[model samples]
Target: MSITVSLLLWVICLSCHAWLQPGRYGLPPPRPGYRPALWGTRLLAPVLALLVTTRHDAIAGILVWCMTASLAGLVVACGLCFGPRIIGTDGRRVARERRP
Candidate 1:
């Protein structure tokens, strides 16, 4: 697959991961009896499989899989850690960028 396509897939995966934890960032809360995090965790397997299949050779396939995994994790972590501050309600930043 083209690098551009791969990047697009990674972005989608990341956004899905972020949506998994919507409440923390003030996006939206999860529904009752439904664990949003669990849904995303389950989805990672299929997404990784799709990403891996994009490459024909074993080496490239492995590399792509690893890359996708790392990027996905980073997205989830960043969303949990910095999402709210990045975009607060009412068009204002929830927290300042400077350290205090």
Candidate 2:
């Protein structure tokens, strides 16, 4: 189950990378550090999910869920906060570079 969750998380990261490529990096070429951080965060999600799902105790599972949810929320908030910085001016620069 943990392996499955890991794979799913990887898939989600890959899809997000593909779909949000331009939006994330503002260029056709991806930045080197971007993928690692994104995938690392994604990889952690399944571990958290597994902790929540397999603890065998209701209270533990609930606590894990809350913690996982908080972590996920933090990840989203970080993305919201930093995503624009990555894609904002750099994206426009990419567009400008493309034009003659």
> Scored by CA lDDT, what does every candidate get?
0.58, 0.51
For candidate 2, the lDDT comes to: 0.51
| TM-score, per-candidate, Cα-based | 0.45, 0.35
How big is the positional error of residue 59 in model 2, measured in Å on the Cα after superposition? 4.8
Native-to-model Cα distance after best TM-score fit, residue 5 in candidate 1, in Å: 2.2
**Model 2 segments more than 4 A misplaced:** 1-44, 79-84, 93-100
Residue-by-residue lDDT tens digits, candidate 1, 4-99: 455455666666555565544545545655565547645775466555546577677667666765776676667566654554545444555776
Measured over all alpha carbons after superposition, the RMSD of each candidate to the real structure, in angstroms, is: 6.7, 9.2
Q: Which pairs of residues collide in model 2?
A: none
C-alpha positional error of residue 82 in candidate 1 after TM-score superposition, expressed in Å:
8.4
RMSD of 1: 6.7
